[model samples]
Target: MTTLKEPVLTKRIPTHPWGDPTDRKVVSYKQYVKTDGYKGLKNALAMEPSDVVDLVKAAEVRGRGGAGFPAGMKWSFLPPEDGGRRYLAINSDESEPGTFKDRLLIDFDPHIIIEGIAICMHACRLDTAYFYIRGEYHHQREVFEAAIKEAYENKIFGKGSKLGQINGRDPDLFLHRGAGAYVCGEETALLESLEGKRGWPRIKPPFPAVAGAFGRPTIINNVETLAICTPILERGEDGPKWFQSMGTQRPEGAPPHVPASFGPKLFGVSGHVNRPGVYEEELGITLKDLIEGLCQGMLNGKKYKSAIPGGISTGVLGPDEYDVRLDFDITKYDTLGLGTAGVIVMDEDTCMVGVARNIAHFFGHESCGQCTPCREGTNWMSKMLSRIEAGDGTTRDLDLLLEIAGSMGALPSGRGATICGLADGANWAVRTIVNKFWDEFEAKVSKQRFVSLSVVGS
Candidate 1:
C-alpha cells in the first residue's frame, strides 16, 4: 500500500471520556459523577428543547454507524410532538463483520451511553427510549444493566429524579435484548423486532423518522453515535468545532456545506496484521498509517495483498489504493466504500477466492430473504464461489460470478434492488475480489485444467 505525506498530528484529545488506561473497572456512579458524567444531561435539561436540537445541529455530529447520516438532522426529522409517544432507539446490535467498537463502549463506558440517551431525549422531546442490545452480548448487557440500575438508584431516573425530568416530563429508558440476527442492525428492522414482529426491513416512504416503533415518530442511533453525545454536550459549541477540525477537509466540488467525516473514529482492525485489535484514530487517517503505524504492519512481516476498509459489506481496496483517505465522502467515488470503519487486512499469502467465498457465505446465510435479488443472489453467488475455491469451477464461472454480483445491485446499479444493504455487501465482496485479483482466480482455474489434462494422458 502507498503511504501519504503525514499530516501534522494535532494534540490528541481524549475521545473515550470514560476510558481509563490505568484501570479497566467499569465507571461507578460516584466515580462518574466526580468526572462530570451527567454534566451534558444537566446542560441539556437547562436548554430549551429546540435549542438543544440546534446545538447538536451546529455541532454537526454524524451517525457513527456505517451510514454516516448526520445525527442532528435525523433528530430534526421527527414530526412535531403530538402529545403522544416518541422514541429514541439506540442500536447496540453490532453485528457487522469485523466490527466490535460498540461492544467495547457498552462494556467499559455504559454510563456515557446512558447520559447521551438522556441528552438526546431532551433534544427530541422524547420521554421514552430503548437500548436494543444484541442477545450475544450477554456480558455487555450485564454491564449496561448494572449501570442502568445504578443510575436509577442514584435518582438519575424514576419519579422525582432531576435527570429523569427533562422538558417537564420524566423520561423512561428500557434495555431491550435482540435475538442474534444481522438484519436487526438496520433501524427499521430493529423497530419491527422491538414491536414483537419478525426482523424484516420496512420499505422507505414513511421512514422511521415519520413512523417508527409501534407506529409512532422515532429516532434511532447506533451505540457510538449516542455515546458521542456526552462529549459534544459537555463541550457545547466547541465540541463540533473540535470534531470538525480532526478530519480531512471535504474535497472541493463536493456539496458546498457538507461536513467532512470529522471526529475520532474507532477502527476495528483485524486479520493478518501485527496487532489485530481496535485502535482509535482521527478520521481520514490513511490506510498506510493505520496498518504501518498503529498495527505495526502485516503479521510476520508479510507484504500486503488487499483490505476491506469498512465491514465485509464494503468493497476491497488493493495495496495501490491505500493512499486514499479513509473518509466517507472520498470513499464514495470509484469502487471504494467506508462502512463501519472495520479494517480487515489480507496478506500476500491469503487466498482472495477463499476470502470472497467466505464473505459471500456469510451474507447468504444472514439474508432476511425478503428481497428476491438478495435472497437468491447471495446463495447462488456463495455456491459458485465455493465451487471455484474447491477447484470444481469452469472457465465460465469467473464471468458468471461477476454477472451475478452486478445483478445483485453492486455499484452503478445503486442501492435500489435489495430491501437493505446486505445484498450490496455480498455483491461488493465478490465483485472487488474478482476484479482486483483476477490473476489469482484465473491461476487456480488454469492449474485445475492442467491437472485434468495430465490425468487424461495417464
Candidate 2:
C-alpha cells in the first residue's frame, strides 16, 4: 500500500520522517489557532449535528483506544436527543504498556485534542465532557488542565460558547485524573471512576452510549481518536475520501460487520529498536519497514526475534511475521486486534518465557477482581509461567499454561471464564506468546534457557 504523503495527525507536533521532535514544545491556544486549530469545530458548528455525525461516519474513523470501533458509528449509537445531561468522556488513560501514542499528543499539541473534543461534543450534542486522564500523567494533566483553562478563557466552552448551549446545557470540559488503575482504562471503569466510584467494568445492555455517567447518555473516546478528527474536519467534505485513500482495503471475504482499517495510524515502537518512538504512518505499513526504516533497525544491530504488533495485548509477531501489515485486519494473523498500535519489539537474545511471565504478571495484577476467570486465570497462568521460568516446571506445567491461557476469559458457554471482553488482553498476550514461541517455552520448561520443543503443539 502507498504510504502517507505527509503526517496528518503529527503535522504540528513534529514527528520523525517529517520533522524533528527536539523542536517540539507545548502549543498554546494562540499558536494552535495560527496552526489552523479549532477550524474543524467551527466547520462542525456550522453544520447540523446529524450532518457532523454523518461526516465522521463517512470517514469511518475507528477508535484509536484499541477496539477499532468506528467513531461515527459509535456517535450514531446514542438513543436520540433526550435534551437531558449527555456526556463526553475523553480517555487519556494511556495505561497500556508500550503505548505512548496518546501521550505524545497530550504532551505537545493539547489544543488539537481539545478542539477534537469540542467537535465531538458538538457533533454528538454532548454538553458536559470529562477528560479522564491517567493519574500518573501528573505533568500531562497539568498541561491539559491549563489548555482547558485557556479554552474556557477564549470562549471555546462555558456559557455563551461558540457552539452555543448543547442539549440545553453549557458545553463544558473537566479533567478527571485516574487512580492509576489499569482497569480504569476500560471505558465503563473510567466512567465509574469519574463518578467517584470504584473502577470496574460494568456489564453491557446498559452501554455507556445509552446510559453512561450518572444514568445519562455518554460518549467515551480516546485522545488520539478525537485528535484525528481535527484533520478530517479540517479537510471538510473531502475528509472521508481523503482518509480512505491512504490505508489498505480490507481483505476479500472479510466479515461485513468488521470495520475497515482505513487512514493513517500512530505506531509506538518500544523495546530493542535503535530509534524507538511514536511514528505516524499509513495503517498498512509492514512491521519490517517500520523497524528497519523508521526505527533504524534493531538495537546494537542484533537481529529481530519477534514483536508485539500493537501492545502486549495484541500478542507477538514472530520473526517471520515481520512483513505483517499493521492494520485492523491484522487479527487474521491471530492477534487479538491492532491494540493501541504500541509495538514492543524483541531482540534475538530476548527470553520468550520471561516476556510471557511479565505480561501475565501485569494482567494478573491489573485484573479488576470482578470476573472470576480473569482474576484467577491470569494469576494461575502467571504462577505457571514463573515456575517454568524458574526451571522448576515440567511438561505438565507447560500444557497447563496453554490450557489456562486458552480457557481464561472465556464466556459461560465455556466454563471457568468471565471478562468484559475488553479485559481479555492478558488472555491473548500470554496465549499468543506461548503458541508462537512454543520451542522456547518448552525448552525453558526443560531447565534449559533455550531448548527446542520436544513435541510439536503439545
Candidate 3:
C-alpha cells in the first residue's frame, strides 16, 4: 500500500486559513493585533500607495469573487487625498450555495482578514473598514465581532493606529451584520444594507469605486482577498517571488488578458465526495484531482455524473469536463462561470433536472424582487423546473425552458423582463438541465405518464 499527502494550493494557504504555526490563533482581536497582526499596514504605510498597488499587481492578487478582477487596479480606482471617509468593506456574506470557504477565514483567523483590510485601507488612503458578515453565520459573526472589539480596545484599529496619518487623520472601522439576504452578497447591495437601507443593487456609473457606502469611494473584497494580504505583506519581495512558482505558466501571446501564473483558490468540496471538506489548491487544479485526491474519491461506490463548479450560479459541467483545468478561462464553457470556487459533485443517482430546480428555487426565493425580470423570471423558471422534476413536463416543456433561459440570460436591454444575477442564476439552472440531461428528462416524463395510465387502468 502507498500513502501520499494532499497537494498544497499555494504558499499563502497555510498562513491565511490554516493558521501560522509561529503565530497565535485569533483567540481575541487584541491577541491578534498584539501578536503582530497589522504587518500589512506597517509595510504599506512606509510605501507610496502606487508602490503598494504595484506590489499587489506584481503579486497578481485578483478578486476572489468569481469575476477575478485585478485587485490592484480596483484599489487604484480610489481618489488620491482623503477622499472623505473612503471605505474598505469586506464582503463576508458567504451565502453562495456550495461556497463555505470564507466562513473558515472569519471564524479561524479573523486577524489575518483584519490585517488585510487595513492594508487595503493603506493602499486606498482610506482609514475606515467594514466587515459585512452574513447574518446566519452566527459563529463567524460572534467570532469576528469579538475580534473587532478587541482590536479597537487594544488600539490596533481606529483613532490611534498607524493608519491615522494617511492624510494626517485617523479613520474608524465598522463591523456590520447583514440579515441573510443572498443578494446582499453583491457588493453594492451589501453597502446598501450597511447603510441601514433595504439591500438592493445600485447601478454602476458611480461604480462603488466612485460613490459607495454613504457616497464615499469604496473597495469591497471577499474574505480570502483580505486574508491573503497578511502573507503578502509578511513575505514582502519574496512573497510575489513565491507566487510565480506555482501552476501552469502563461506564455506571452497565448492570451493577452490571462495572467502568466496561477494562484490559490480555496474550494469547499461537498456532496457525493468521500472526504467532503474544504481544500485549498492551485487555480488550475483538475476537477478529477479535486474529487479523487483531495475529496478522497466518491461515496458508496457511486459513479460521478456532473458538478456545479464555483457555486449554484456557476453552470453545470458533465463528467467529461471534469478533467478540464479549473481556471478563469472558463469563458469557453456553456454552463460554467468562475463563481465562488465551490465544487459540488453529484453521482448518477442525482437528477440533473432536480438539481437544477433546487438551485433555481434558491435563487428565486433569494431574489430581492427589486427588478421585474429577475423577480418574476426566477419564479417562473423555478416553477417550470419543479414541474419537470416532478415528471409533469412535456417534450415541448424543454423548448419552453430553453426560451425562458435565453431571455433571462441575455435579455434585450429594457425590452425583455430580466436583469441581474437572480435572473442569470435561474437561467443557468434551466440551461444546464436542458443541455446536460435532455435524455433523463424525456425518459422520466414519459415513464411517469405511462405509469399514471397503467395505474388508472389497473
Candidate 4:
C-alpha cells in the first residue's frame, strides 16, 4: 500500500492541476473554480464545435485507454448533428489489471473529469454523457455522484447555467455502475452494458460514431482522455503544442509532426517496485529511467528481471528491453505492446512460468464466453500453464500452448478472431512469457518429469 511519490522529472507539465496530490480531501467546486477549472468549458462553449475538435487534434492528445487513438480525430468521426441526439460515454470501468489512474482521478479530482465532460459535451453537441464506472469502485462512484450533484447545484448542468446549456437545452450527465466485468472496459461492450444489455462487443463497420447507445451517434472516450480536454481547450493551440513537445518526436517514415506519443501520462507502477502506486510522467520516458530513477530500483535491492511496461495486456518486456521508450511507439519494438500505462515490475526471483499461468487464469475466468477462440483458448492456456507450474506438464504441452495461442490471433498482426481485446491480452501474456522465457518453461517440464521418475523408482 505504498503511496506513489511525486514524479522525478524536473521539467514536468502540470498534472492534477486542481487538487493537491498530498491532500486526501476531494477538491470542492469552489476550490476547483479558483484554479480556472471551468475555463476550458467556457472556451469550448465560445468556439464552434469543429474548432474544438481541431484544437484537441492539434494538441495530439491520444486516448489514455491502451489504444492510443487520437482524441480529436475520434471526436471528428461523429456524424453531423442533424437535430438527432448524440451521447458521450466515459469509459470509467477501470478494471484493467495493474491500472488504477482513473479511479484515482475520480477520488481525488472528480471535478476535473466533470469539467472535461462538460467541455466534451459542448464540443460534440451532446446533451447527455454517461459515466460507466466499475461496480467495485463504489467509493469512486460516490465521489462522482457527489461531484455531479455539486455541479448541478452550482448551475453547471441545469437550465440557465452557461456551462450546462447549449442552445437553451440543459445537458445531462449520468453515472452507471458496472457489474465488475473486465470485458466491459471495451468501448462497444461498455455501450452495450450501458444500454442495459449483456456486455458483449458488437462487430464494427457501424462504429460507435455512426450508431451507438440507443442507435444514436456516440463519442466514447476513456476517463483520462476526456479529462485532458480541460487543458487542451485552456491552452488552445498551445495546449497541443505543449503536449507534443514532451513526448518523443514522430519516428522517420511517418507523417510530418506526428508525435510518437504526447502529453503527460499517468503510469500505474506496481509489483515489486519500491513505491507501488500511480506516478505521472511525460510520455516517452524510458522504462529504465522509470525503474531505476523514479522507482528507486527494484524493491529490497533485488535485480530487475522483467516488467510489463504498460498493463498486463501489453505483454512483458525482459530486463534487456528496459531501455525501450515507454510510449505508444513501443510497438515499433519487436514483441512489445503498449497497453494502458500500467507497469507491473518483477524482480529477479520471480517465476515467469508462474506469472504467465496466473495471468492466463485471470483472462480465462474473465472472458465473456461469447467468442470461442477467446473463451476456449484462454481457459485452455490457463490450464496448460497451471499444469506446467504445478510440475505436471509435458514438453508437448508447451508447444501446444503456443500453437493454440498463436491461432487465437492475439498477437498484434493476429487480431480479428475475437470481438474485443480481452483475448489478445490473454494471448500476449502466454506468448511473450514463453517466447522470452522458453528455457524456464522447458526446465519446469524437465524437472517435473525427473521428479516423477525419481518418486516412481523410490
Top candidate when judged by lDDT against the true structure:
2
Native-to-model Cα distance after best TM-score fit, residue 159 in candidate 4, in Å: 2.0
- In model 4, the Cα lDDT at residue 226 comes to 85
Regions of model 1 farther than 4 Å from truth: 1-22, 163-169, 332-336, 410-415, 447-458
lDDT of model number 1: 0.79
Local distance difference test, per candidate?
0.79, 0.87, 0.72, 0.80
Best by TM-score: 2
lDDT of 2: 0.87
Q: What C-alpha root-mean-square deviation, in Å, does candidate 3 show against the real structure?
A: 5.0
Across 69-162, the per-residue lDDT of candidate 1 in tens digits comes to 8888899998887788888899989998989878767766688888888888878988788999998999998999999888878766777766
Error of 1 at 6 (Å): 18
**Candidate achieving higher TM-score, 3 or 4:** 4
Cand. 3 TM to true fold: 0.88
Residue pairs whose backbone atoms clash in candidate 4: 59-240
State the local distance difference test value for candidate 3: 0.72
User: How close is every model to the real structure, measured as TM-score?
Assistant: 0.91, 0.95, 0.88, 0.92
lDDT, residue 449, candidate 3: 40
What's model 4's lDDT at 204?
A: 79
Considering summed lDDT, which 10 consecutive residues are worst modelled in model 3?
1-10
Task: Let me know the TM-score candidate 1 reaches against the reference structure.
Answer: 0.91
- lDDT for 119 in candidate 4 is 83
Cα RMSD (Å) between model 1 and the true structure? 4.8
